[model samples]
Target: MNITINRAAIESIILEVPDVAAAEAFYTAAFGLGDKLRFRASEEPTTGFRGFILSLVVSQPSTVDSLVGTAVEGGATILKPAKKSFWGYGGVVQAPDGAIWKIATSSKKETGPATRAIDDFVVLLGVDDVKATKQFYVDHGLTVAKSFGSKYVEFDTPASSIKLALYGRRAAAKDAGVSAEGSGSHRIVLGGSAGAFTDPDGFAWEPHLASQ
Candidate 1:
């Protein structure tokens, strides 16, 4: 006889919000996650969890969506805009459970089929000096990888995997495909796991742990 095991593909979830109204508006506007998938009041109530969908609450709804939106819009050139019925698009959102939402624009894909069935996660970070930042991870116990043009970097850790990029504060803004006056926050809390420090130039890095 043959046997098989079943598992949920999505390993992690992050939701961001400034206020209830804003959270409701942003997720609906950005990911089309459907408004108030959980509650009808502002009491922040968390319902039950179904499979991979984990709900977290946000105190406020205002979030930094411009950068994320721009990146998704740019990447859409190579990918496809997420559809309502898509497997990658189906998830639950709830209140009171402390839902943390990260609102980024969806992408549109080309004709090629996906070799890998599911994408686990995509991480973006800021860096002041690419060379020095890359070295720091190498020394602090991360296996570092990079693209040829110094455009992107990656680090593998036991707890988690992270993508560390070298962007000259101003240039980094352009990488995100946005225009910002100065530097953004360069820190990662790592959900209480091991944390990594950035270099003098303000390059930040994080570790991602693959869920089983």
Candidate 2:
């Protein structure tokens, strides 16, 4: 089946950390993603299941290798080493603030015709209930591109450089080979002009006004 969706863009990712300054520095040097990362500090530590992933889809295998190398050099834990997968050359990393990231390239050279190259960004959130979260975003004006019966959901966010997606909590964790015991603050913020609101998992979505 084919699904067409229209929705707003994703401007930036807001992350809540125990120390904003440190996180800013770590991400800045690690993946050169500092430009897209915004930081806020919380007085108390975070707890519970912090569910989400910041994905970078590159177009070249070399770029993927370079990015993964930089992340390791910049103090990121290589949760999953980069390698050839059915999807392409990909790997996982846990950032200093405990955020998970999947870096990959879908170039035909790496993935053949199975997956096309994605020279873009995608923000995937791990949620306790995919159906409920998907409904919440739909009610708030976001559109869906594709979805699987309460297991996964993808939004039709093309106006911005980053796309949005949702996955089952345990499923997402299992994919990353990490425990789903995240607590405290989710430290995620969705940037858009859609107004301010919070999701069921306590993740914040704030409005973004384009510069005049």
Tens-place lDDT digits, model 1, residues 1-212: 11111111112223332354654554444444331131222332223221111222111112212323433443322122223333222222222223322222233232243221212233344455656666765665555545444555655433222122334444444433334343223212222123444445543323323331
lDDT of 2 at 211: 38
Top candidate (TM-score): 2
TM-score of each: 0.40, 0.84
Expressed as tens digits, the lDDT of each residue in 111-169 for candidate 2 is 33232333677888889899999999888878888999899999887543468899998
Stretches off by above 4 angstroms in model 2 are 1-8, 108-118, 209-212
RMSD of each: 13.5, 5.0
* Candidate 1 vs. true structure, TM-score: 0.40
Model 2: lDDT of residue 62: 66
* lDDT values for all models: 0.32, 0.74
